[model samples]
Target: MKEITRIIAFYETLKRKADVACALAMVVYVEGSSYRRTGARMLVSEDGFWEGGISGGCLEGDALKKARMAILKSKPELVRYDTTKGDDNQIGVGLGCNGVIDVLFIPVDFENENNPIEILKKSFENNNKPLVVITNSLKEPELLGKLFYFESKQSIDFLKNHLDVGLFSEEILALEKSKNYNIDNELRLFVEILPKPITVYLFGNQYDIYPLIELLKMLYWEVRIVSEPNKIQNRENLTIIAPSDFSENLLNKNSAALLMSHSLEIDKKNLRKLTTSTVKYIGMLGPKTRSERILNELAAEGTKIDSNKIFAPTGLDLGASTPEEIALSIVAELKAVFSGRNGGFLRERELPINERNQEIFKFN
Candidate 1:
């Protein structure tokens, strides 16, 4: 999310100067292990200036050359890099990543609304829900590099006559993550799902909240404060709301709340309101006993709290003692929770680190 935001900002700057000659390189498919997964993108200009990355710096130099070539030829090109080979001159030589990645470089057409960057910008404009992008990668020159953005059933219905509606609808419904689809050996489509940014609600006015806010901002997540607006500095992606005005309507499934006001009354009041919310993750700052007591009090008052969603004595046990270290621990735990992961040592995990629903569909 952060990388795409930077790419868009850079593209806008270039647009302002009337220098929109560039190419967008995106990792559309990956097999085995990769440093960056599908949907990772980089923008390259004719003069070799670039932003974002598709690899761990090993593939960017070569991707830059390929992107410039695509720009010059005014065509879309799919370049595959197999890192499993041990050849010294190979692109992934020494990385030992043991992956095959397919990158799509599309020359940007500023005049076309269906261009890659324009489609991406459209996705950002309405990010309250997931946006599905279909990129044609093979065979048809007119369709190649063209992007289809689907955020509504109306949009899907509009394309029913032109596409395999059944296959596309099934794939979109079953898409938990991004993948490439091969259609009867005639067409290849990269179906990318772009999710909305995570939102964090900090229900406190304490000084310790600043560190966590900074970390969330770095990740490009939205941060909101449910306390005194004047207590914190106003900045981008940060919203300040008064306690009286804070309501459950401001939260969604992608939202998390951290109660760190250091006051028992404030935490209890906020927790009560959050229990009635659809927000899944709620963290309370303090000792286990205190949080438990607060929950017990709430329970006695006819409020049933979801124990699974509550993280009392919030944050992973990182042996943190200082404010900054505690903030790091909290943010780390939040990431793990949202990603459906346990905050444990990565070396202890048996499966692949980036493994998920990665199955590819072949439609007839």
Candidate 2:
């Protein structure tokens, strides 16, 4: 999400100038193992400026040249890089990643409303709605580089003529991540899913909350400080909401709350408000005994706290003492919880780092 945001910001600056030529390089397909999977993108400008990346530094140089060519010709081109061949001269770099990567370079047309950048901007402004982006990758010349955005079941009607709407609808309904749809080896569509960003509500106004907010912003997650508005210093992209103005309805499955006011009364008050909400995670900043006492009091008052959703003394066991270190631990735990992970060392895991299998569909 942060990469996407940076690309959009850079593109917006180019749009304002209205003279620079730029192309978007996106990894459309990946076979075997690659540093980046599908949907990874980098924006290249004619002035030799680039933002984001498509590979682990080795492929960027070659991708930059291809993107420049695409911009010069004002055409969309697909280039494949085979790294399985252990020759440094192949791409001028020893890419022993044992992977095959396919990249698509599309010149940006500022006038076209359906341009790739424009489509991405729309997806970013989708208000946390899940969006499916269909990009033509093969065979059809006219449809090549063409992009379509679908947000709901009704939007599938637009693709009925070109795709198997039944299967596509099922994929969308199931919330599948992203994959390629191959049709008789003639046409290929990269169906990419853009999910909502994780939202965090900080129920505090203390000094420690600053580091946490900064970390969350660096990850480009939506962050809101739920405290007295006057207590928070005005910062860009950080929303400050008064505690009285906070509502549980604003939270969702992708939302988390951190009670870090360091005040027993304030934490208790916030916990009570979240009891009836549908939030999946509630982190309390303090000792286990303090949080347990609050929970006990709430339970005695018939609050019915969900033990599974509460993380007393929020954060992993990182032996963190400083504010920044503690913030890092808490943010790591939040990511693990949201991803359904146990926050363990990757080296200890027997399975692959990315264990979720991507499914591909075929249609004639």
- C-alpha root-mean-square deviation, each candidate: 2.3, 2.4
Instruction: At residue 47, give the lDDT of candidate 1.
Output: 82
Please give the TM-score that candidate 2 achieves against the real structure: 0.91
Compute each candidate's TM-score over C-alphas.
0.93, 0.91
| Tens digit of per-residue lDDT, candidate 1, span 231-312 | 7665545688998899998888899999999999889999999987889699999999999889999999999888999998
Q: Count the backbone clashes (under 3 Å) in each candidate.
A: 0, 0
Error of 1 at 94 (Å): 2.5
Which candidate comes out best when scored by TM-score? 1
Model 2: lowest-lDDT 10 consecutive positions: 128-137
Question: Residue pairs in steric clash, candidate 1?
Answer: none
**Positional deviation of 89 in candidate 2, in angstroms?**
4.1
Off by over 4 Å in 1: 128-139, 152-163, 233-237, 356-358
Candidate 1 to native Cα RMSD, angstroms: 2.3
Q: What would you estimate as the lDDT of candidate 1?
A: 0.83
